[model samples]
Target: MHIPELYCPIPSSVVVKDPEAGEELIRWGADQGFFSLDSDAANLVRAIDIPLWTALAHPMLKSADDRSFLNRWWTWGAVFEMRFDTNAGQELDGFFEKFMDSTARTQIRILSNNPPLRDGEDFSEPMDRTLVSLLRETEQRFGNPWRSRISRSLLASAESGVWEARANYLSQTPDFDLYQGLRRHSYGQTYITDCAMMAMGIDAEAKFLRHPVIEHIQYLVALYGGFVNDLNSLDRDLYANNRCSSVIAYRHQYGVTLDEAIRAVVDMCNGYLRSVLAIEAAMPDYGKYSFDDQEADQIDSFFYILKMLMRGNIDWYEVSPRYNGGWKPGGPIDPAPWG
Candidate 1:
């Protein structure tokens, strides 16, 4: 049984700019509980680590590496996930509410008969002023149509994760199709397209994303990602009272032992990986237009990035202590297998 190999050589250009970016991202992932060894860490780390990894691994061209979009998205994605565990609506609500409260307080001070003089006196504290300014700046930034577009895109992605999480928590029986669908969106697979486009150029994402074949390939990529996660976190998932796993779900559905369940998922993931490679190999037939050398290079780069993600995920999972150290394999079957 042959399996596709995985490895991503760091591009020299990326290394030149940020020599340690890849290593740092890997270390950050390990510490943030993506590894089995770090099982004691908060599960909420998923919100942070996944987005950050995606952002860090974004295949922006050398020229665009300095753009803040990736980092900004990573920050907001983490915040969104944290809010999911606590209160999803509160962060947005609180952002506005805090600003309004501060404004009202400032207005009241101005309307009152308070003296404007006094050496150490101020209408608002320094920290309050900073907060207000930040709020104003954030409002102004969002007013930009480009930022607004990305914000909407990210919000949609976050909503998918929220839905999938809910579904996983509620489901007891294994529904492979449902799991794949939810996993693709929940794991931020669509963002791979976005990142690839960013790497290619301004409209590159739009042009390539419009192709029906590319959409099909992207779906496979998402499945590969999700299954890799399912395999890596088998132990952690069981420990965390999580049954939203393909392996356990399969075992429940088929009444198979843990080892059999693992084998089935590995086969499923391998099939998806093979599909991705086949798409890469058949790019000429599927591409919407003929490309000159430059355009061809761009397309090749896009696929390379996608493969990098596929391989990078497996590498991260193997090395990360959060997935490896803490849990034992083949524990007692969880009685409630739906979750």
Candidate 2:
């Protein structure tokens, strides 16, 4: 592989449990009705240990069942991308038609308003049923407010998927600067942090959500994760002819070697990590927002999950076989180059 070692600054007390977590992953999937052993989605997960990734990303989970719910929930973004972002993916227009046409009636409601699932309600399409189930479960565990906040990020995630699909549809690669903006969302950080928050079962008032410092931390978490993904997947993305990577963007815009571009991207990621740390430390008093003890705890969880997001799964990226195969006939869905 041409990828060089990346310097990730954030720390994680990651404990990737052994065969036990793997076995429990199945039971958790079965209990939640999200993952299937024989499905294409199952084929996709074989490339990397997603359950382990989920566990590593959200260490706040104290229970086995909690870890599994989040592991499966975190994997849904990939499943959605494969369904709508891959070659066999639905037409871009149809994706909007299927998912975006109704501003409030369908998924937005399921995500934000969060109506209860009836005994057999087709609240969403078959694929999205899992997401709806996950969201409802989030509401049950956390509360209507927490679920609503998570829903907002998830809506952004879906829209970001559309942005990514749009970029893929265009013959030319997205503009370097514009792509960075899109990358912040397209790479799944928004939903990743939100999923972690849901698992932690934390909530904040509207003012905290709108606070500038809080917003900046959220932005840095997403930016840092996107850079981490771009750096690690550089080899696989190059083989697949996908040039939307920030590393490639730097190299393309400036006459730099691939190695230089990789280094520059790594430096950029480190900078974001430093920024998150500084911001977390210098967080202004929330007294201005009249934050209660519960809201203050929610703010603390934000920092915790932010650290987890900024930690960037570098361990998994190094080991997980992510689409690094070249000219291979077939591969598992998780690591497959295209999706």
Candidate 3:
């Protein structure tokens, strides 16, 4: 329950600099075609926000040496972003309704003839299919076959168990236990969606979790005890009737003063940083060398960015205030803080 004393090595640059590397990475990403968006589609997306595209693309290009994996990661990210944008207009009701409808059909097929299930029984099929369909529709609309193909490939890989191992590992980690507890108690229903969104953001079309990057992101979330990202958006979530893990967790489990909660949140972030440093130290030279120095730098920058944002300064563009407000504990505090 205490913060670990781990430390990640600091990298030179917070952002990528090599133009040739950038171009090659983009081209390779285009060729792999995992996302629903093509070069043209990616370009269109860039038009909406060039910085965001660069932030996403630069890391993939820097870390992944394998042309195939790099391509798949970019493609998957591109397509997923497109689908997310397309669905942005939808309210929670519409999103859930669509999700539920897709789940029902997929569940039926999974249970009816897929063996290991008796007739008329319920089963928890993976939610990747719903995500896949959404990405496919986005790709079809944009005519971005490269991105779509990568998405399909990623889905195939996930079905084969490439990501499950990672998921199982993270879910069982001690850090995740504290994180999940906070999520379940404070955040409410929004906790699951936030987790799913984070999952979607980093997952490669449901194929593989981009090891270090995904792990890094999750590490940060767990460090904040799974609420910082959702903190700013508390009002919106409440408006939309969304539940947040931190809100629930703080109220039911760790009922304490705002000062105490903030302290705990900061400690969690510190713990997360330590955990990453530990992982990096243990990572083999060429064994899981997909992530390079540039990627590590980005992780560091983003982590600090979140740290600063949680402390107070609001950057609506980079950090949506409605959705990025830091989490504060709720309910009556105990006379003494729980150790």
Residue-level lDDT tens digits of model 1 in 1-339: 222333234331122224344344334434433334333222334322433344335534445333343533343333333323311212443443363355434422322314332343444443323323322343354333333334334444555555544543444444665666666655445554454455345343345555677677777877677677777666656555555677777777778888887888888878777777887877787554534444666678767777766765665554433353433434222111112
Instruction: Compute each candidate's TM-score over C-alphas.
Output: 0.59, 0.78, 0.37
List residue ranges in candidate 2 displaced over 4 A. 1-4, 14-20, 23-40, 87-124, 254-256, 284-298, 321-329, 333-339
Worst 10 residues of 2 by lDDT: 326-335
Q: Which digits, one per residue and each the tens of the lDDT, describe model 2 over residues 81-148?
A: 55434343335455544544543246545654456546667743544577777777877877777767
Q: Could you list the CA RMSD of all candidates, in the order they appear? A: 11.3, 4.5, 14.0
Alpha-carbon runs more than 4 Å astray in model 1: 1-69, 82-153, 168-174, 200-205, 285-295, 324-339
What is the TM-score ranking, best to worst? Answer: 2, 1, 3
C-alpha RMSD in Å of predicted model 1 compared with the true structure: 11.3
Query: Residue 267 lDDT in model 3?
Result: 57
Best by lDDT: 2
User: Where does candidate 2 clash, by residue pair?
Assistant: 44-333, 44-334
- Model 3, residue 26: displacement in angstroms? 16
lDDT of each: 0.49, 0.63, 0.35
